[model samples]
Target chain A: MKLLPWDYGVRNLLRAPGRTALGAGGVALVTALLVTAAAFVRGMNGSLAETGGLRNVILLGAGSEDSVERSEVKAGVAGIVAASVPGIEERLGVPYVSPEINVALVVNVDGQERQASFRGVTDAAYLVHPQVRIVEGRAPRAGELLVGRFAAARLDVPDERLAVGRSVDIDGRPWTIAGRFEAPGTVLDAEIWCDAQELRVATRRETLSGIVLTLADDAQTDDLDLFTKQRLDLELVALPERGYYARLHDFLAPVRAMVWTTALLVAGAALLGGIDTMHASFAARIRELATLRALGFANGAIALSLVQEALLTAALGALVGAACVLPLDGLAVRVSMGAFGLRVDGTALALGLGAACGVGLLGSLPAAWRCLRMELVAALRAD
Target chain B: MSALVECRGLTRVYHKGDQEIRPLDELDLDVDEGTFTALMGPSGSGKTTLLNLVAGIDRATSGTLRVEGVELGALSNTELARWRAHTIGYVFQLYHLVPVLTAYENVELPLLLRDDTRRERHRKVAAALELVGLADRHDHFPRQLSGGQEQRVALARAIVTDPRIIVADEPTGDLDAAAADAILDLLGALRRELGKTLLMVTHDPRAAAHADRVIHLEKGRIVAAAAATS
Candidate 1:
C-alpha cells in the first residue's frame, strides 16, 4: 500500500504548535530533573573519594570507625606509631604524621551563630593531606585560624567576613584569621584549622580525635593491618583512608536513593501526562486517519507516522533540558560532611535523550493503534 | 463491455446492543468496465456500504464480491490494501485532505507506496494537479484553499496513482451549486477521457444526471435501474 512520506509527521507537529510546545516542555523538565539527580550523586561520590587517598591511613579508637568526630585515641600514640611502624611516609627526614583534635564549635560572625568543624593540627598535617593548598596568606599558629574558602559559605557568612586579618569569636575566644586555603574537591574545604595544643587547652580535651598519616611507597593496607594487630593493647584501629570514605558513602546511601526516587516519580508523571495529551490529539484526527486508510495506507504506516511526530516533539524537549543542565556543571552543593561539585557530563545528556525518545514512542503508539483499529466506516463517520 | 465489479448476494451485518443491523443484505449488482454509474438512495439504504465494499476498505460478511477479477472477500487485509492502492481511487464527501500537508504533498501520497524515484513522483504529482486545474495552488495547505479548491485537490490526489476505478461518495455533498457542478463535470471527464470506471453514491438527483446510468436503492435492495437521460 501507499506509505505516508516522512515529512508528513513534521508537518503534523507544526500544525499544532501550542500542543507541541506543551508536551515538549513537560519532557524537558523531566530530563533536567534526571540529569540533576545523576550529577548530584556523581559529585558527592567524587568529593568523598578526593577527600581520602589510597596511600593514607586513619588511626581511630577501636569500634569508632563510623564517625571521626566521635573517635578518640591517646595524643602520644602519634609518636609511638611513627617510631614503631616500618613503612611510614617521610618527607625531608620528617615522618608525615599529624596528631589532630576535632571539635564541633559554634562561631559568631556579624551577630549570627553557626556551627563549624574546628580541626587543630600541626605543620605536619599539610604533608599528609596533600589536597590542601594555601591559596592566600600563611598557615595558622597559636591564637590564629586558617579558614577554608568554602567554610565561609558553609557558615552562611560573606566571603569577606572570613578574610585574612578578620577576627571570629569561637567559644568565647577571639581568634584572628591568618589565611585562606582550598582543598580542591575534598570535604576538608568546610573546616576551620588552628593550633592543636591551643585547641586542646581551650576545649579542655586531652585526647586526640584521630591521627592521619601517609604510607610509604609500596606499602599496602596489610602493613597497617599488621601494625594494628601487633599493638592490640593500645586499643587503636588502622583503616585505609579509602575504606573510611567508602563507609561514609554507605552511610549516605538513603540520601542518594531518596533523590533518585523523587526524580523517577517526576519523570513518570511527565510521561503519563504526555500520553494523555497525545491520545486526545490523535483522537481528534480519527477521521483523517481513516481517510488515509481508505487511500490504501495500512494501519502500521499510520501508527509509525504518529510515533515519529511524537519523537520529534520529545527531541525538542530534550534540547531544552540539556541547555538547562549546562550551567550546573561544577556547581557546588554543601552537606554536613563538606561541599561537593556536580559533574554534568555527556553521559547525563545521553540518558536524557534515551528517556525522551522512549516517552515519545510509548506515549503515541497505543493511541494511534486504538484509532486505527476501529471499523473503517465508523472512523470515517467521526466528526 | 466486460464487467469489472460483480457483487453476488453480498451481505454485511453488524450488531448493536442485541439488535442486528444490515446495511447491504444479500444484494447483487454489476458494473461494466469504463462505465460511469451512480447509486442513488436515501440515508441508511446501503449505498455507502456498497461503495466501501467495492473500494476494499470494508469486507462482506457473506457472499462473493469481486473487483477487477480479484475476489476481495478471499484476500487478507494487507493484500487488499495493496490491491486498493493500485486499483481504486476513493473520493470522500468532506474533501478529506490532510490539513498539515500542501496540495502537492497530499496528491503525491499514493505514489510513495511504490518504488518511484523523486523525479518520477514529482512529474506524476505535477501532472495530476495540472489536470485538476490546480498546478499553481499545489503549495497551499488544505486550510488555505477554498471548499471548491479543496475538492479539486482531493480529486487530483485520487487520480495521482492512475487507479483503474474511481469511487466517490457524495463528492459534491458539501459544495455550493457552482462547485458541485464543476466537480461533477470533472468526474465525467475522468471516465470519458481517461477510461477510468466511475462508481459514486449520491442523494442529489442533479448529481445522478451526470452518470451514464443510475441505480436506485431502498431497504438495502435495488428497486430500479434506468439510463440517466430517461
Candidate 2:
C-alpha cells in the first residue's frame, strides 16, 4: 500500500550501514584538517596585535608591511614631530611620545643564534605603553637594559646572567644586565627594551629610529586620519593601532588563505568522492527502487526519500568533523614575528565544521537526484 | 461484442536505425469481461505487442485501442501510467519480484497507490495471498519459493489492487510442466471464481487449453480463432 515516502530510502541506506559510515568518515577528516589551518592563521594575527595602544607607527621611511622593521627614521625627526604635533597622549602633563632608536642584534641562545630587534626607549616609554610588566629584577640604570620574557628564555639568559650588575658586549658597547619583562606572549615579548638616549650614545646612532605615540582616549577621531595624512616630513606615515593589525592581517592573509584554501580544495574533492560513493550506493539498488515505484509510490516521494538519506549522511559527517578538530584548541606553535612562539586558537574548528557541512550537503544533491529519477518500468526491468 | 479490451485496426511498428518493422499489422481484437483468453504466436509475430497495447504499457502507432472503455492511445505517457496502475495488472515471464521484499510485501505493492488504510491494505493483501493459496508463504522471499509459488506470488501482485484486467506475458514459459499446470489452473480459477479478465500470451499447449478461447497469429496477422478450450 502507499507507504510513508522516506521509509524506503532510509531503510535502503541502513541496509548498507558500512558504506555510509565510510563516506561520512572521509568527509569529516578532510574538514577537520582545513579548520586546523584556519585556526593557525587566526593565532598568528592575534600574536602581532599591540593591546597597549602605543603609536610605534613604525613610521616607515619606506617599504611595505613585511619590511616595517627595516625602515628607519632620523632620531632628530622624533624631536621635531613632538614639537610640531599637538595633543599627543600624555601622562602627568608630559607629551605621550618617545623618540626611540631601534636595531636588530644577533645573539647566541641555546646554541641557536638569531636576530632580536631591540627597541631603545626612554624612561617615558613605560608611560606611553603600559602593558609591559617587569617579571623579575629592577629597571635598568643608564648603562643597562631589560629583556622581554620570551627573549630572555630564547637566549637562555639565566637570572645569574641577567643580574642587574652584569653586562654583555654588543657592537663593542658593554650592555649591563637589568630587568626582565613579559608582555603576554605578544610581538613585544620577542624584543629587547632599553633607554633610548643612552642606547643612541652607546650605539653611535645619531638619528632616532622610530617615534612612538599614544593618543588620549578622549582625543578627536574625525581629523586624525586627515592630520596623519597631511604630514610633510620625508614621507611621514601614521597608522591607527587597529589599522596596523588590520594591515598585518592583509599582509599575512595570502599565506594563511592559501593554506586554508588548499584544505577547502581538498575538502571539495572529498565531497565529490562522497557524492560518487552515495551515487554508487543508489545505483546498486535499481531494482529496489523500481519495486517501490511499482508499489505505487509517487515519483517525488521516492526522490525525496533518497535525498533524506544523503542529508543524514552529511550531517553525521559534520558532527564528527567538528569533534575531530576540537583538540587543536589553543595549540602553541613557534613562528618568528621577529622572534617568539605564537599559539593558534579556535576559528579553525568553526571553519572545519562549516566545510564539512557544506561539502556534505552539496555532494548529496546529485546522488539523491540520480536515485529519485529512476524510471519505474526500466528499473523493474533491471531485475 | 462490446468488450472490456478492444483493438480496432491496431498497428505497431519498431524502428531499428533506419528500418521500420511492423509488429502488429492493423489487427482487430476484443476480450470480454470475466473471460480468460490466450494468445499464441511465433516469437516475432507480435503476441507481446498486442498485450502491451491493450494493457497501456505501449500505444498503437495508429488505430483505436481501449481498455475498460478508456481510450489508451489518446492519453499522454504520464496519464497512461496512472491508468495502467489503476486499470491493468501485468505478469512477466520471469516472475519479477523485488528481491528485498517478502511475498506479502510484494503483493501489497500495487495497493500503495490506493487510498487504503494500513489495516485495509493488510486485509486486502491477505485476501489476495489467500486466493493464490500462498497465505502460509507470505513472509517467504521470491528466491525461497518454487517456480509455481513464485508465479502465484506474481499473480497475487498483479491482482492485489483489484485491477479489472490482468495481462500475462508468457506466465508459464519458464516453469516445469507441473508448475505450469498450477499457474494455468490458477489463472483459470481466477476467471471462474473471482470473475477476473485475464489475457495471457503463452506457447504452452496445456496453458492454452485452460483459456476460454485461443487466437493464433502468424506474421502479425490472426490466422485462426478457437473456442474449444472455453
For candidate 2, lDDT tens digit of each residue in B1-230? 68998888889887889999898998998889998889998888889888877877666889999877789878875577678779888888888776657899888777777788889999999998998899999999887999889999999999988888899999999999888888888888888888999999999877888888999987778988888453
Per-residue accuracy of model 1 over A1-383 as CA lDDT, tens digit each = 34578888898888788998999999899888888888888778777777886788999989898888898888899999899887889988899889998878889887789888889999989999998999988999889999987788678777799999999897778999999998866778778999999999988887998899999988776767788899988788988778898899888999999999999898888888988999988998999999888877899989989999999999999899979997998766778776667778787778777888888988898778888899988999899
**Stretches of candidate 1 above 4 Å error?**
A1-3
Residue B73 of model 2: what lDDT?
78
Please report the candidate that would top DockQ against the real structure.
1
Residues B1-230, model 1: lDDT tens digits: 54899999999998999999999889999999888999998898999999999999999999899898999988998898889888999999998999988999999888887889999999999999999999999999998998989999999999999998999999999999999999999999999999999999999999999999999988788989888972
Model 2 C-alpha lDDT per residue in residues A5-97, reported as the tens digit of each score: 354455555677899898778867786677667666665666566543644333445343344455566666766666666666766668767
- Cα misplacement distance, residue B178 of candidate 1 (Å): 1.9
Residue A128, model 2: lDDT of 62
Please state the error at residue B36 of candidate 1 in Å: 1.3
For candidate 1, what's the RMSD?
Answer: 2.4
Report how large a share of the reference interface contacts model 1 reproduces. 0.77
